[model samples]
Target chain A: SQQGEEDPQALSIQEGENATMNCSYKTSINNLQWYRQNSGRGLVHLILIRSNEREKHSGRLRVTLDTSKKSSSLLITASRAADTASYFCATDRRNTGGFKTIFGAGTRLFVKA
Target chain B: DVKVTQSSRYLVKRTGEKVFLECVQDMDHENMFWYRQDPGLGLRLIYFSYDVKMKEKGDIPEGYSVSREKKERFSLILESASTNQTSMYLCASSFQTGVSTEAFFGQGTRLTVV
Candidate 1:
């Protein structure tokens, strides 16, 4: 079963606009990671934020994690047409012996030029 | 750079046929994972291996079996392919066991069972 859920199944934004996607998980996690998938391709690792950390940034991507709320958000600043793709948030949950990472349903973002 | 590669980009097989999906990684990662992606169901884990000759069942592993005979190669096997099994299969590798670690994924293979 999936441990996380992402809001806004799909989003459309004009170029240069900022896009935000949110994800919520069910259990305690050691960290949360965001991924991007292009059409018919595999997922690309975007950024990872540990539970102890609150915010992280990579290039134009920003990820914020609130362990207290059990939720995380991904923000893309100055979006471009090439940034259009599916975004997924994966949660690493502390289980019995080893941890398992569960992925959410994902949000599809379309950046119109 | 770490490179994860899948054997095929697309495949078509008849129902009841045995199918094999191969994945290879050059980064000498310790963990490998198999996931199937559908329209709205997102990506569901089928199997994973932490080391050579060791495998673990993921959330949806009933119809799939995995083999990790080598450190750099992982294979997913379907004993009898069914029409419902037609979906995109993705392979990924990671270097660490913790949740904070990042994973590298292959391009994925679209399989069609007819």
Candidate 2:
């Protein structure tokens, strides 16, 4: 089963605009991480936010987590054509004796140049 | 730098044939994973191993099996290849540094089962 689900299956905006993607999960998670994938390529880790953290930022990326609502959002400021890619949010949950990371469906973001 | 390398970048196999997709990580990470990416289904975990000779089934384990004889290597096997099994296969490795560490992924192998 997919533990996390991202809203807005697809999004398109101008190069200078900021893009926001939201992810909602069902169960409690120890941490949430966002990843980026270009077309026909593997995923790359972007940023991670622990459950105890409410927000985090790295470069142009900003992530916010709300445990009470089981949701997380990724905001990309000053989007560029190079930022055109698919974004996914993953939840790291403790299972059995180890941790299992599950990813969401993902949001396809297209930054028009 | 952490490097996870998949055996092949592109593969073509016939139906009913046994297929093996190999993955190797140079970081000596304890955890390795195999995931399949589809058009709309994102990346779905197929199998993962936390230690040598230890394997666990992921959400979509049907039609797929895995082998981890060495700590730095993980192999995903398809008993009998089918057209539906053709997709992008990704290999990743991560160390349990703290609560949950980030994973490093390979370029991915695009497999086509005819």
Pairs with backbone N, CA or C atoms under 3 Å apart (clashes), candidate 1: none
Per-residue CA lDDT of model 1 for A1-113, tens digit only, reads 88888988999999999999999998888889999999899999999998899999999999999988999999999999999999999987554425556789899999999
Against the true structure, whose lDDT is highest? 2
Measured with DockQ on alpha carbons, how good is candidate 1? 0.70
B-chain TM-score, every candidate? 0.97, 0.97
Q: Write the per-residue lDDT of candidate 1 for residues B1-114, one digit (tens) a residue.
A: 999999999999999999999999999988888999998888888887878998878899988899999999999999999999999999998876655479899999999999
- Model 2 TM-score relative to the real fold: 0.98
The value of fnat for model 2 is: 0.58
What is the Å distance of residue B74 in model 1 from its true position?
0.6
Error of 2 at B73 (Å): 0.4
lDDT by residue (tens digit), candidate 2, A1-113: 88899989999999999999999999998889999999988889999899999999999999999999999999999999999999999987665437768899899999999
lDDT at position A100, candidate 1: 58
RMSD for each of the candidates: 1.2, 1.0
